[model samples]
Target: MSMSRTWPVWARTMVSRGIYSRPRTSQERLRRAVEGKTVLITGASQGIGRATASRLAAAGAQVVLTARNESNLRELEEEIRAAGGEAAAYPVDLSQPELIDEMVDKVLAKHAKVDILVNNAGHSIRRSIDLCYDRYHDFHRMTAVNYLGPVKLTLRLLPVMRAAGAGKIVNVSTFAIRTPPFPRWGGYHASKAAFDVWLRAIGPEIRADGVRICSVYMGMVDTAMTAHTPSLHRLPTLTVADAAGIVCDGAAGNRRALGPWWCAPLEAGSVFVGRPLDAVFSRLYQRSSDTDAARRAIL
Candidate 1:
C-alpha cells in the first residue's frame, strides 16, 4: 500500500481531525511534534512546501523556511506565526549553486543546529529531450536544484546532525520517476532518480549515526509546479495538505519513505516477476482505466 494509504484513514488524518483542535493548556502534549526543535524546509513558500510548513507549525516545531521569493516566504512566515507556531523566512534561489552552502551556513550559524532538514525545492519540465537540445543546461538547472544542491546542503549539514546524536531528513521526490513515465520529463525524472540513488546508497551509514533519512516519492498534487499539467494527471493525487502531512509525519517520527506509492507494488512485483514481466505489466497497466490518466496522456 502507498504511504498515504498504508494505514486506516483515522491514522492518516489523526493529526488534523479536531483531535488536537480543542487546544491544550498543558505544554506536555503540544510539545511532542515541535515545541522547541528547529526545522529547515526548502521551497517553503508554496504548494507542498507551504503545506509542510503549516503541518510542522501545527505540530509545534520552530520552522526556518526559505525559497526564491522573499515576499511569498514572508507572507507564509506571517501566517504560520499567527497560528502561534514559530517561523522564520529566508530567501534563497536554490538553482543558484553557490547559495545552497551559504544558506546552509546561515541557518547553522543562527540556529546552532538543525534538528530536521526537508529538501523540498525542485522544478519540473514537461518538455521533450528534443526541445532540450542545446538546452542541456535545462537539465543542469533542474539537477542543481533537485539533486546537487540538496545533496550538497545535506552533506554540509550532516556533521552537525551526527554530532547532535540524532536527526531526520526527508527528500521530496515525484512519482513521475516511475511507470507511465511522462514523455518530456527526462531531465526532471533522471535528476530526482539520481538524488534518490545518492540518498539510498549512504542511508545505512547515516542510520548508523542515529540519523534517519526518507525519500518521499510523491504523486501528483495540486501545486503551481503541476498547474500546467492536466487535472486528470492528478487522479487519486493527494492535496498539498495531504502530501505535506505524509512528509511531516514521516520526518517527525523517523519513518522511511513517505509516498503516494503507486510505484512500490510494481517494483516489489518486478523483483519476483523480473523487469521484463514488470515492463509488460506496465504496458498493460497503462492501457487500464486505473492508470494515472495525466501520466498516460503526457507520456
Candidate 2:
C-alpha cells in the first residue's frame, strides 16, 4: 500500500481530492528533518518568505530572515519568538550589488554556517520589449535582483556549506519559464530563467560536495505580488502557507524539483508544440488588450 493510505481516511481523502496537498511524510518526520538546522530565507519580510520562515521555525529550525523591510522583519521575528521559535532578521536590498558582498560577510560573521538556503527573493516586470524600448534601467534592475543577487549570495555561501559537509538550497522559481513564451514579460522571464539555468548547471558539481539544489517551479499564488492583477484577483491560487509548505518539503526531501502536479503535462506539451502554443497565447493577449483599448476609445 502507498504510504499516503496509512493516514486516516479524512487526511487521505483530502490528499486525493487536492485540498490538503502536503507531502505524504508525517509531521514528526518533517520536524525531525528540520530540527536544529540553521535556515536562511531571503524575502522573509512578507509573502512566501514570511510564511516559510514561520513553518520552518515551528519545525524547530533556527531561522535567519532577510529582506528590505526592517520593520516587517522585526515584527515577524517577534511573532516567531513569542511562539517559542528561534529567528533573526537581516534587512537587505538585493538590487544593490556592492551591499551584497558586505551583507554576505556580515551574515557569515554571525551564523558561521547555514544548513539550508532558501532563495525566495525576486522582481517581476510585465512590459513588452516595445514598451521597454527606452527603459533600459528596468531590465538592468530586474536582472540584478532576480539573477545576480542570488548568484552572489550562493557563491559566497558555497564555501561555508561545503565545510559543513551537508547543505540544501531551495530556489523558488516561476512556472512561466516552462510555458510557451508569453508576451510582455521579457525582462522578468529572462532574469528568472538565467538563475534557473545557472543553478542547474552547478547542481551536479555541488552534489558531490554534499550540497543539494532544489528548484520549486511555482504556479500562481495569492500574494501581494499578484494582488494588483485584475485577472488573477478572483482566480483560484495557492495560499502562502501552502506555497511555503512545498518549499519546506523540497528542503526535507530528496526531490530536486517540486511544482504543481499539472505543470508536468503542460511543460511536456510546450516542448513538443511550443510554436503553436506561443502563437495562440500571443493572439489571445493581444486581442484582449486591443479590445480593451477600443472600448476605452468608444467610452
Candidate 3:
C-alpha cells in the first residue's frame, strides 16, 4: 500500500523526520493547520501530553488541557498564555465514568466544538499472569483508563464533530499492540489492542462524514512513566518532544495511521511466524527472569 496516496507527501515526511531527524525545522504548515483551531488533549499534566499541548499552542491553536493534576495543568496553561498562546486547563480523571460525561459537557460548553481530539491518556501495568492471578483489579483499572475512557469520550464528541462537518481524532497507541504479545503485559496490551481494533473497525464508517481518525503506534518513549522500567533505559527511546511532534504532525496531516516504518514489516512477521516468534520471546524472557531472580537472591 502506498502511504503517499493516502496522505500528502509533506505529512508523511513531517512525521518521519519528526521521529528520525533532529533539525527541528519550523513547522509553519502544521502551525497554519492548528492556528485558530480548538484542540483538546488528554493527560496534559506531564510527559507527552504536556509536550503535545505546548507544540499545538505554539502553533496558534486554542488548546484545552485535561489531566488529574490541577496545579500542573494550571502551570502549563499559564506558561502557554504567557507566551501569547491560547490555553485553558480542565482537570478530570478519565478512570471515572461519570467524570467522562461531565468533561464532555464542560468542554463542548466552553468551545462549542472540538476541532482536534488527542486521546493520550492511558494506564499501563506490567506483571506476569502468575503474579496477577489474584489481582483482577489490574484488568478493571487498566480497561477503564486505557479502553473505556477514550471510547466514551470519542462517542460523546462525535455528534459535535459531525455537526461541524470536519474533525480529527488522534489516538496515541503503543507499538506493542502490533508486535507479538509480551509475557508480562497482559492487562496493558489487552486494553490497547481492544481500542486499536475498535478504532480500525469504526474508521471507515466515520471517514465519509469528514471525520479523520489517525492511530499512532509509537515505540518506547523516554518519559517519567517509562523511567520505572530500568530495562527500557538500555534501549533507544525518543524524547517526549519527538513523540509529541509525531502526533501533532499526524493530526495536522490527517493521515490514516502514523507509525514507525518497520511497524508493517513487524506485523507481517508476527502473522506469518507466530509460533516461532512466540518461542523466541518465551526463551528470552525466561532467561532474563532467571538472571534477575539470581541477582536479587545475591543481594
Candidate 4:
C-alpha cells in the first residue's frame, strides 16, 4: 500500500495542515492574474504538474500540457476541455534535448506566444554513493531530466518571452536544495542546484527585459515520485493540490523565491554552521539503512 493510504484520516489531515502550510494564492487571485494568458506546463500528466494545469485552466488560462505520457496528457486535455477550459497536449520525453526543441517549436507555431512557463517535471533517486560507483548512468540520467532538459526548454522559450516584453518562468524546485545536503541524494541535489543557480545568475540580465523568474522551492509531497521510498512514508508531505496552489502562487506573485516557512531559517543555519550540520547528517547516515527501493534495486 502507498504510505499515505496507511495513515489514518485524522493523522494525515493533521500532518498536512500542521507541517505543510496552505498556499496563499486564492482561486479569484489566480483567475485575475492568469485569465486569457497561455501557460505551458511541463510534466502536466501527473502529480503537482497535473493539478496545476487543471487549476490554471479553470482560472481561464489556455494551458498547454507536455509530458512523456501521451495518453495521460490527452486524457487531461479532454477533461479540461469538457470542463469548459482551453487545453492542448504535446507529449515528449524531456530527457532528450532534441525532443524538447521540437516540442517548443511546435508549441510556438500553434500558440504564437507562451506567456507563462512552469518547469515542474523532475526525476528523483535515492541510492547511496557506494551503490552508484558502478551505476554512473544514475547521475547522467538525473542531470539529463532534472537539469539539461529544463535548461533546453527554457532557453528555447526565453527569447520569445523576452521579445514579448513580459513573461513569467516559474521553476518548481525542491526545498531540499535550501537545507544542508543529505547522504544518498547527492546526484539529485547537485543536478537541481545547477539549474537553480544558472537561472538566478541570469535573472538580473533578463529582468530588464520584463522576463521575471520565480523559484518555488517545494517540500516533499505525496506523489508517485516519492511512493517508492518507504523511508519517506511516515514523514509529513504536502498533497498534490497543496503543491499546485504554491506553484500558482509562484506564477501570480512577484516574489523571486517561495518555499515553506522554515526554508529561509534552514538556509541561514546551513550557511552559519555547515560543518556541524554535516556531522549530524553523517551520523544519521551511519545509523540508517538503505531505502527499501534502493535495496530492492540492488537485489
For candidate 3, write residues 1-299 as lDDT tens digits.
Answer: 22333455466446545544322325798787889999999999999999999999999999999999999999999999999999999899988879989988898898999999999998777665666666788789889888998888889988899889899998999988888898777789999989888988888888888988988887677676675555655555666788888888777885787777777888887778999988998997786542242233221
- Tell me the lDDT of model 1 at 127: 61
Candidate 4, 92-161: lDDT as tens digits: 9989999998898899999999999999999888888887788888889889988999999989999999
As for candidate 4, its clashing pairs are none
For residues 173-278, write the lDDT of model 1, one tens digit per residue. 8765654444456778989999988988888988878788988777666577765555334233455666776676667555576554346776566566665665
Better of 1 and 2 by lDDT: 2
- Deviating ranges (above 4 Å) for candidate 4: 1-14
Task: Check candidate 3 and list the clashing pairs.
Answer: none
Q: Write the per-residue lDDT of candidate 2 for residues 65-84, one digit (tens) a residue.
A: 99899999999999999999
Order the numbered candidates by TM-score, best leading.
4, 3, 2, 1
TM-score computed on alpha carbons, candidate 1: 0.79
Give the C-alpha lDDT of model 4.
0.90
Weakest ten-residue segment in model 1 by summed lDDT: 16-25
Which parts of model 3 have CA positions greater than 4 angstroms off?
A: 1-26, 290-299
Displacement of the residue 179 alpha carbon in candidate 4, Å: 0.4
- The stretch of ten residues in a row with the least summed lDDT in candidate 4 is 290-299
Q: What are the clash counts of all predictions, listed in order?
A: 3, 0, 0, 0
Residue 247 in model 3: lDDT: 83
Write the number of the candidate with greater TM-score, choosing between 1 and 2: 2
lDDT of 3 at 260: 70
Tell me how candidate 3 scores on lDDT.
0.81
Q: What C-alpha lDDT do the candidate models reach, one value each?
A: 0.72, 0.80, 0.81, 0.90
